[model samples]
Target: MPATRRPIRQLPDELISQIAAGEVVERPASVVRELVDNALDAGATQVTVRLQSGGVRLISVEDDGQGILREELPIAFRRHATSKIGNLHDLESVATMGFRGEALAAINSIADCAILSRANGFAEAFLLDGRTGELRPVARSVGTTVEVKELFYSTPARRKFLKTDATELAHCIEAVRRHALARPDVSFAIWHEGKLVEQWRRCTDLDPVIALDQRLGDVLGQEFLTQSMRVQTIASDNNLRPRIWGRVGIPDAARTRADQQFAYVNGRFVRDKVLAHAARSAYEDVLHGHRQPVYALYLAMDPARVDVNVHPTKIEVRFRDSREVHQGVRHAVEDALAKPRSAGLEVAAQLDSAPLNNGFSVEVRQPQSVPMYSAQPGIGLVSKPEYRFGMQPDMPGHKVSDVGAIWQRETAPVADPIPQEEWPLGRAVAQLQGIYILAENTQGLVVVDMHAAHERIVYERLKNQLNSITGAGAHPRTIVSQPLLIPVTFAATPDEVATAEVHSETLVTLGLVISPFSPRTLAVRAVPNSLVQGDAVSLARSVLAELGQHDASTVIERAQNELLSTMACHGAVRANRRLTLEEMNGLLRQMEETERSDQCNHGRPTWRQISIKELDALFLRGR
Candidate 1:
């Protein structure tokens, strides 16, 4: 028997609201995120959050922000009604964190919700019951307070999906942490099970940098500031306005998971693919394959260029031009991480400076170039007979030994003291274990990993030479390409095929020759000569993939860089090679002029300083 179809009907308001709630109120943490967004949007200076039973039983948020009017109390719980926006134009540039107006309505549909508020000029506060639509006079300060109880009580099925109490509480804390990081001027406090668990005090400093640093220390831990590098960049091209600034942890501080990574757009915490990919690409050379880079990066741009309405949670954003954002973030982070660790050494110097016994004040100066080694082939590697110290002829009354002739010729006379500001890394005193170079400076002692330092110097030189050869506007006599005898062919997606056809010129410039052989297959005919050791098929596939995703290809350059890195490592001076004092000092001088000389290709520190005060502390001096 054929069953008769039932007539379609519209859902009741209560049922419709519950369905919408399902999207916005997934768990306790979701509720916390919505409430906090509302508080911040209201211009709250201080916000307090209290939770019980992992916020499944009770969740309360109180903020000293502009409160709602008594007449608008009921409207606040109606879906699609909000004061954040009034027209379609307002939607294009939504600066506030919570503008959809679905948060209050969604929360009320699944839990017992109540809002208590007293407008600035109101004589008394009013309370509205979300479940019964009842209004009553209540005593409250000139702000807003939202209390939610028995989360998902109306939806038994949803309640069953929640995790254990501890896990939920942890997520709630993380939500608040994200907000605290975004607004340093706002104080935030959180309590769970009637105990204060975390607090971030409001920053009062007038200097933005100082305030941000203080807040970062308070939220990410003081150790993070000590171990991380500050990144700031301003980029604007055409109508696109982008500014990326934040702190990125050094490669040594990377973690296994991506939990510590944070990215925000227009002050709203987001999980954008462009931002994530940019950061990961920047760290490709430095971080281990399994480890994730950690950073708190904030990107500020005109709101009109980004759309936050793509998702119900508003945690994902769509940019008008993703390519620009990708370039901006990637370049900014790369430039920051590529700076020499000399800045840290300078800071250490200031902290370690003390009065000498003879009343000579030790002053640490900014790093400056000093003459050490005369230009010679393979100066960064083993010293050849043709290589000589630039200072060799300047020193008189010094005997040059065959084995240590370079060292004796360049060494300052025993009677002459080197000025404090002359050399930051100081003069080579001795070698340790044939691996480390020990030197003495005004502050204290300097120990350097000779192999690592030399590797970095060589790698930088190789990169610069490559850039000069292939850089824009440089006409090369011939492109260096290695033809693959087999002519590897592989299947390709339509987007990949299109990218190859469109960016073929770019590929040629990078020394790759790819052609579309069929509708869905591509043939790799040639690759960069420098990257001949790498798999041609894999390199072609990676390049196509990058072009498809980023509209830009870095595969060829990255592969060439990897090859150069290997060459540098092999060509660098090896441990136990017994370098003379002049060779050691030459490396030090080169490091000061080389970019990113602090860490090697593998991201390990090349040099470290030990202050005299630190040595004294070790020996318990003056105690």
Candidate 2:
């Protein structure tokens, strides 16, 4: 059976506005975000937000910026009446936050609203009421104030969807937090009921980077500042291009959730897929398991290249060239995290003679390197000889056959006095239980996880070898292969068989050879040299699935990296293995030169510093 369709007619203005309101206003937080956006677009330096009942009963935002004229007061509440854009050209390149101008009209249809403003150079102010459309003279300074009360009052169904007061209040606060993180030169304050909740003062530094760093400490926390690395880079092709700057947390600071990640394009906050995927790719090699990285990255580029009108909330954006943006962000983060943290540590005085508890303090002398007086002649306490891990005679990916032959050492004479300050890792003194290395430095004590440190060193070396063999130009490079004595067979689905046949050349470059044995089975003839001991069937299936869904070259490269990582893990030094002082110091020196040596291949810290102050507090000296 068929039913008759309703007649198409233009709805009344009130009914039309309520329908528009459904898209613009979701909860109290929605109203707060819109009002704050408008305030910021008005060039406000100081903004204040007041809330009651989690912003349902009352929400007021006051800002000191350019105000509107009295004659345009009534038309400001009309649909699509925006001062930001006039024609199609202006809409194509919008720099202001509130361009659509549907917020005021949509909000007025669902709640009680009012606007009081006084334009700069004007003598008097005016107030406009939403419900009555009444305009009268008012007393106010040269700025604007917008008040929204009884949100979703007209639509009872919408009001039922609200959460508790405390939960809603938390959402309101988070909305403000996003804006605060993007702008460091503006002051923001929030008040709930009659008490002040949160406030962020403006950073007065002349340098933008220094100001942003100060604001990050104030908003995120001092701990974040201490544990994260600063990223500032400009990526360009020909003329000026996008500039990226922010703070990325170290591998050890990764979080269990993605709530702390923020990305901005041209001073506007957005959550685009290209940015998210690029960030995740940059951290794929370092982070372990399912941990998420925390960062706040800002990108500055031409406004015409991005379109912000993709969503009603303006939180989603579209880029003309997504690949450029992806590579720029990924490389920026990678370069910032490449340098080892040990290289940045500064040497400080170990003991402060300031008295505590009115008692005398003991002065401790820094450990000095023995002047070429060790048991082995020509080898000083901390050797300056060249020590390197010897590669196999054939290829680089093979297992390190012997631990004893790993180091290639050469002795050199020491003329000048060498101190511990020159060696950041200090001199290796002893080994603990054959699993840890103990050392003394200018700062204090340093404990090294022997197995974890060696694993990272081996992993990095394997990557360099593979890169050199492949010519390191772009992806889809060839990997060296080794033939197996006997072929392995596996049951394959119809789709898997088809994928293997279609991408046969791709498989060959990755050092894999798979052929159809029957209608339902496949045979693996060869495998990568480093993954010779791995499961041939499982590796073939994983590669087939990835080639079926994602980009072939990317999937092949990732699979090759997985094989190298596995080889490095198994070839590292094992626990309960004894080593001499020379071997232990050799490992420490390698760690200092390796990039991202602070964390192992699995994102766990390989070593930690225990400053002298911590040691003093533990023993309660001078107390």
Candidate 3:
């Protein structure tokens, strides 16, 4: 007869696992940690981690640690079954990083976990069932290999929350790197999907900064790493002993994300925004809006002054001397960015893939296009933004017009190219898709998205209106306000309803009239002529998206931004569209006159650059 099974009287198994999984599994990174912890506990001197497609489908961690004893194999998944610590008081002053004993329980609860571990004296391997926490005898390698398949299997909601494969993989890679760096004495080999990714031999000397070179070298390429800026500062006081030291590649040593700006406290990886704020504070004059300087920073402080158990991920940290820490970061960033490697430091730029008006790509590099103003001597963050693209819309997330090249014929619609002496940025190379403009800047090439660029242009116009001392300036643009034959109505959230009301008049100011039709409904009676010609629906949708994220900005600011973004989208160049040199120059000149021209409406930098030295190295000239 089969043994009587105890009924799960209370909760459903799925619900139970989901709750347990929260602590055990978050993303692919979480799985990597639990697996590595198991390996380390097994006394593994060498660990190998493998991931594929961001760990969506696979995550394998192998280690040569003291493998699990045959009988204790099943106990690994039982909650609180940790070898790190035993009993209650040990939890308070936990010596090991992970001793909750929940890592395996939590992981197995969410994912299809398979574990095979064998002790040194064991004659055969152990097959452990993660689901039931059951152990049995089997034959396998002496070391341990933990495989996690179908993560978040019991929690469907969490599966949707996972980021793209690339993003998730990046996070996993970062986590693995942290572990590898932390345990330098442990030989680490990382492979993914049948291919060897990284083979790092064991290090007799483990310094946190060692991985800094390896990490940056992978992201920025070793060529740039060869010539990095090193800056250091020392300030010792009873109240504060702040020391700053790091290497920052010239402005060109940049990445798509600010991943390189690592912050560490006491040899532990931490994410401190205040430190980031300080880092940004250091790059105040050097970097433009869309760019961030790169560095690997290590901060030291008394253990009592800092706290690490603040977040589940442990990325964020609290400092005892917040001010001193901030000051230290600022010193390091400024000093490193200011030094001599400035010669080879070129900015990472987006390829000008948009079609050009000249019938061929305008291959030219411009000089530091982050404008050198006659009105103001040099660049400063607090100071007004300098014109990089000639002219820019006043705000963020708007389209820029591509007026790269214009025709001199009588049939031409706009003016001719303004001379470069007057405003060199005003010159155009080509206009693409009716929106993006390929223009030449002094330091490097500038590619302007007409819609994003124009959004900035119009945003500035509205801002000037707000700041203008001229006439009450409420004068309507006097152009016709196109009416939709059928008014468009939308269901908005409570905040969006308030957002519509606050910006109702502002919308009217921009030639769009929005009114509350119901508690959750907003009626769009009229729209800007530009929007009406295209898709007014998309323009109206912007209000809902803008309000959902944050409401700190006033309705006027939000509405106005939405309006400008819409206008830029409608008026700026489109893909495969064409324009003349005159149009391009006009666009560039406008960007020059405007402020905050580096990035488009969405905070993406409109133009980027790779220095001549970088180009030469690409061709092996500087090698």
Best by lDDT: 1
Off by over 4 Å in 3: 1-24, 37-45, 52-54, 66-75, 80-96, 118-127, 137-143, 160-171, 178-187, 197-215, 218-220, 231-246, 342-623
Q: Residue by residue across 1-623, what tens digits does model 3's lDDT show?
A: 01221111222343333321225478998888767756765667788888877886889898876676766667677765556544434433333455445677777888888888777766788878787666777677778888888888778899999999878877777777766544555677777776776766665445535545554455445654554565556646663555555566445455558866766665566778888899877655335567766766666555556655455454556776788788777877765654322122322232222233443344444456534322221111012221122122223323333222111111222234333543434345555545567665444445667665555555444444444454465554322345666677777778777866765555565566767889988877776543343344456667445644545345555455554654556534444444444445545655554554444555544543433443454457856
Please report, as a residue range, the 10-residue window in candidate 3 with the lowest summed lDDT: 377-386
Clash pairs, model 1 backbone? none
* C-alpha positional error of residue 241 in candidate 2 after TM-score superposition, expressed in Å: 4.4
TM-score of 2: 0.76
Report the error of model 2 at residue 33, Å. Answer: 1.0
The lDDT values for all models are: 0.74, 0.73, 0.57
In candidate 1 the C-alpha lDDT for residue 524 amounts to: 81
**Residue 476 local lDDT, model 3:** 45
Clash pairs, model 2 backbone:
none
What is the descending TM-score order? Answer: 2, 1, 3
